[model samples]
Target: MPDDFSWSDFIQRALPLAILGLALIGAPLLIFEPEGLPRMRSLSKELAQVRAENAELTRDVSKLRAEVRELRDDPAAVERIARGKLGLVRKSEVVFQFGKPR
Candidate 1:
């Protein structure tokens, strides 16, 4: 409507506004529509589960390493494992088997 109005000037102003509008709309669409918050939460939960499992395995490995050292160096440790896990006894030891009463 104004004399200064031309297609180039109109396009210059309208193009930036259009791009800004699309950015405003598309930013939220990128975050909240399909693969955003929910995916992040799922990944976070999986990471936590993996970290917890890794910590548990680390503790188990440490215990196993200590047990291995003990078994290698201490004859008493070997006997304890043999007696507890394999139900072994010396030839002179007496055996006792107690059953639960119903």
Candidate 2:
């Protein structure tokens, strides 16, 4: 509106603000675009896998605890383990072998 308001003056006044606005808009992309998003996705997948493995291990531990309790409190369970794992027989029982000859 004034005679002294020239193109140079307009550029001088607008350049710094334009630069600042562009920096504000572009800083995040510059900082995060290359690696941050992909790394976050990778870490999220790893966390999910770890949680799944942890749940499976927790189930295994519970099963083992139940087996331990059964083996401790139930004579039948102990006898089964002994016969199946240790090949033990009662004193009154006779052993038999019917396998093919080696």
Candidate 3:
């Protein structure tokens, strides 16, 4: 048994260094590892963006479904799209010509 260095003193001195070494190892794992905290945060942001995009796509699908239903079931809907988008007119309708100013 050593006179100056006891078991209690060795434990006290080595405990803080051991803890610090563990903390140093753990910090790199937390910040830089592939499946670490930083990756989890990145995945969280990606998940939010995907959710928002999914919501927007859902809304667009709903709108398209409604438009499809209207165009399929309503003659007026077809006529409105034709007249507005295709510049179509019936045989008996008068046509007007407008010119842009130079």
- Which lDDT tens digits does candidate 3 get at residues 1-102? 667978888999999999999999999877888888778999999999999999999999999999999999999999999999999999999998999989
lDDT of 1 by residue, 16-102 (tens): 999999999999888886589778888899999999999999999999999899999999999998999998999999988999998
Relative to the true structure, how large is the alpha-carbon lDDT of every model?
0.93, 0.93, 0.95
Q: Model 3: residues >4 Å from true position, as ranges?
A: 1-34, 98-102
lDDT-wise, the better of 1 and 3 is 3
Error of 1 at 81 (Å): 1.5
Quote model 1's TM-score: 0.73
**Can you tell me which runs of candidate 1 are displaced by over 4 Å?**
1-3, 6-8, 91-102
Q: Write the per-residue lDDT of candidate 2 for residues 4-96, one digit (tens) a residue.
A: 889998999999999999999888886688577777888899999999999999999999999999989999999999999999999999999
Of models 2 and 3, which has the larger TM-score? 2
Name the candidate that leads on lDDT.
Answer: 3
Kindly report which residue pairs in candidate 2 clash with one another. Answer: none
